[model samples]
Target: MKRALVLFNQALRWHDNLLLSEHAYFDQLIAVVVLDPAEYLTEQYGIKRASAQRLQAQLKLLLDWQQQWQQKQLVLHLRIGDTTSCLLQLAQQYQAQSLIAAEPTAPEQYQQLKSTGLALRLYDINSLLQHQLRPDLASLPKSFSAFRKQREPELLVQRPLQLKFSGQFYGETKLALDTVSADFISRYHTPTAALLNEAAALERLTKFIWQQRAVLHYKQSRDALDGDWNSSLWCFYLANGSLSPCYAWQQVVDFEQQQMANESTYWIRFELLWREYFRWQMRQHNSAWFSKNAFRPPLDFSAPIPDKRFELWCKGQTGLPLVDANIQMLLHTGWMSNRGRQNVASYLIFELQQDWRLGAAFFEQHLLDYDCASNWCNWAYIAGVGNSGARQFNLIKQALTHDPHGDFVRHWLPEKTTAGALVHWPEAKVQLQDFWLPFLKQLKSKA
Candidate 1:
């Protein structure tokens, strides 16, 4: 019997661990993804529950994977409870001589995963620049430009590695679709294996920004919240480890060589480095990143979660256009663009003066790309609770600046209007049929 070498991660949708596994380099390869049911059920220390959207997105990605790689030995292990121990049990079940995974992004989870001593090979897909850039960013950039200034000059955008995981597969798939959560599997929806495979990640990196309508005009337009392609959707893919930051950087390099270059293109890379800095911060701070005393401070995060406020915010009824629109988009689809997230998070944390963790929980619920390191750390930063000291995003100012015309606000909330209020984002409102009545029908047909 070829020695079994299995791989596991929270969502194996091309996350570092699976990327290595896809090389098909193991004999009787056993692929597993164990979901901690507790993560969803646990309240934000009693701040309502994190949105279930997170699990749904995972299921969606998994179903897409199974459709294409049906022959691959993917043991979709849904550990309803005892997630860590379940992983250990799965490794033992297959007699997995070696366990391969990505470095942990969360603190307690890392400690738990590390407890297993089955020859673990933890890799660096977790960091954008790997180990090289983080020490330089320990004092994570207070602003994007400063971070880029410190690191971008040295970034080589290492050529993509086709690290193959070769050998016999398909000897151990202990579980199946019938045994797992059916509702969970249905949430993720993508049309093609091209959508599920690593190729999808690479394609998104190239085509999402540079190819069609590049972010070259992003600096001015990124604040134009309602439009498409204004910002790179790289965060979603990067959060899931679906897309590699370096690969995306290579595309940026390609763009500079072959296409127009500007602040927008540069800004996109800058965000990638920003992401690296946050991950480095996560390693440095651990659980403290999410706490109120986060910046060595004086706030109680364990306070009771305000249900009414949380419900209104999550359901997109915050009376703020950008906030409502972004939340609605996230609810309907298990993803939100970066523009929407920043606006929404600001409203949840600063405007409403609600807890940042409550907002983070909601995002964790729905964001298909919810990376704990980036999401919470960012929420903390914008809420002025992050380790990088004080940084706050004002809600009203953000709206006036980003959606000056109110199209994005109008798209999400159609009935209300401040005629003289939005002088710039003025698209003459055609007497649209009762605001989204027609739009809802259209969405249903597509879904």
Candidate 2:
């Protein structure tokens, strides 16, 4: 009997139903994902204990996804230690034929997977286009505009419907979802009985963005910090493979054929390319993608010179209204908007002068849609240190320019000004310089 196990890691996603729908074809499918033992350890030591708590919370989110999916009594496996060793052991014990997964981005981890001697089958489950879709992502382009131009023509766009297994190896699964342990899901996740798969992801997209020609307005409003429908909620699903990127692009194509194309519709494609550029950065650089100095000078993840100040930044109490509100929302809900994301990231790397890696690590620890390549590559991109692009946002300039009226700043930062009288208040460069002198010092040291 060629029996195999499907590994489940609640690192950022739960077991994917789109993938699991193919489960019926395998003789025996035992799904598994192991939480690395090192997850309990502090990441960079500056925010050690706080990070450990966030890791636990992320695991809890995954557990919720697993419980919701394991209704069929699917052979779900959960262990908190070495994943490769566990997979190999189970594969040997079952004589499984192949292991199927959406390939991971971490070079060292992927190498470990390559050496495992299993017939590893990687599908285009995450990306709308492959990393090399654009000829030049493989070669570092000098500018974002150039990178975007090179990619637009060559987008290998396609949409494959979610997989549904045919044929029957009608055997019962051994594992049950109840055995999994985690509490954050029960405490906070929004309750819904909808089909929790790629189909559902599509349905949500239609209702939110595609149905009403709303995506036609996306290019203009995507940077709007507070629009609920500002951006596609695709990351969390794409990160988990509950929804595939090809399918997402197809929905756009269908919408464009029926409606006149606009920058908003085109912008969606642009962002998808921007997302792939990061993936290619990983392919071109390999291990160096994880290194801090791949683009600019090395980041200073050493220590927070003013430790209390860093805590204040983390807790959303920096006296900066827009930045504070976004941070608080993330701490409460494991989600944030695209504009909100840029605002907070800008605050960290620019205003706080904190190490960009530290900020990326913090995003990985908390973002429900955490993709290693996207998060770190993005951090590098924004910090003038990744890929070939050298762009960095000025947090104050962004705040005043975008949130001029401070609706975004006050939404989660009501304490700064109870009535938002200063919502459009101009930020003082002196305050920014004084608060972030340590960070500028580090950057200057490298210069």
Q: Which model scores highest in lDDT?
A: 1
lDDT of 1 by residue, 174-284 (tens): 454333344444433334312334556766666666577566776666655544566666666676556666667777767777877887778777777778777777777
Alpha-carbon lDDT, every model: 0.60, 0.60
Any runs in candidate 1 off by more than 4 Å, and if so which?
Answer: 1-5, 8-29, 47-52, 71-81, 131-147, 168-170, 173-200, 295-304, 307-311, 335-339, 417-447
lDDT of 2: 0.60
TM-score of each: 0.78, 0.77
Which TM-score value belongs to model 1? Answer: 0.78
Each prediction's RMSD over C-alphas, in Å, is: 7.9, 6.7
Candidate 2 per-residue lDDT over residues 1-447, each given as its tens digit: 556555544222322234455554466665666555454345554544224335554455455555554664444555444557766866766677667655666675577567667777654446655444534444666566776687667776744644564232222345332222233234333433122344456676786555656787888877876666777777766665566566677678788788677788878878877777777667667667556665444633344344554667778777666677778877766667777787777767766777667777667766766677787788777776754444455555565557665566666765556333345333453265454454344333432
lDDT of 1 at 131: 55
Residue 165 displacement (Å), model 2: 1.3
